[model samples]
Target: MRNVGAFACGLLFGLGLIVSGMANPAKVLAFLDLAGHWDPSLAFVMAGAVAVAGIGFRLARTRSASILGAPMQLPTARRIDPRLIAGALVFGAGWGLAGFCPGPALVSAASGQPRAWLFVAAMLAGMALFAALERLAAVRAQRSQSSS
Candidate 1:
């Protein structure tokens, strides 16, 4: 049941990407190109997405928990630390270089864009780096506990 629901949701998301012209790397690249031939259609699409998600999140906040699940796992950390800054910098640079972010990269993976591969590669590298950092932090925490 869960697998079926997940598959359906993924299918809908992919269809949305296709419908929004987000699955085309050239379209994305053109939108990001501010010099010669800048296409602004993608900006509208992104604004629509932000509007929808913003309203949805606001609605969700009014509820204690989802009907089918527990309370949303919202991040509560408010500190602006070095890790956050570094991660944001990396993400921004990768987006500028690839033009297609993670959502579009996954959608266009079926289209065989070389730049899409680079986007996915960098995305996975970021995730792997996060995992390694988390492991190191755990080790350091354990060492401190033992020393104390």
Candidate 2:
């Protein structure tokens, strides 16, 4: 049942991307190019998404727990941290350069775009790098404890 819901959600999200012209990198890049041949169409898509999520979250907050009876996991990191700031900067840079984030890149890759493949490769590399750094930090902490 959980898998089924996840599948349905993914399908709906992909379909929404296709319908919204977000699956096209050109459209996305145009939206991002504020100083050039700027297009504001994607702004509407983002606005609609934010409005939906805001209202949905508000409704959900009125309930004690989720439908699965599990508490919602919300981020509590309000203070700006170097790691958080660096990660956000990296994400924004990737989005600006590729004009395709994870979702759009995945969708475009379905159509066999070589550029999408490149973006996906770089994105995966970034993810792997982050994971490796986390493991390295853990190992360093262990070594420090042993020495002390």
The top-ranked prediction according to lDDT is: 2
Candidate 2 deviates by what RMSD?
Answer: 1.8
Q: Which residue pairs in model 2 clash with each other?
A: none
TM-score of each: 0.82, 0.89
Please give the TM-score that candidate 1 achieves against the real structure.
0.82
Candidate 1 displacement at residue 39 in angstroms: 1.1
The ten-residue window of minimal lDDT in model 2 covers 67-76
Best by TM-score: 2
Q: Over the stretch 1-148, how does candidate 2's per-residue lDDT look in tens digits? A: 6677778888898889989988888998999999999999999999999999999888886786666566776555689999889988988888888889899889888879899999999999989998999999999999999999
Q: What's the lDDT of the predicted structure labeled candidate 1?
A: 0.83
List candidate 1 segments past 4 Å from native: none
- Model 2 misplaced stretches (Cα beyond 4 Å): 63-65, 68-71
- Clashing residue pair totals per candidate (backbone < 3 A): 0, 0
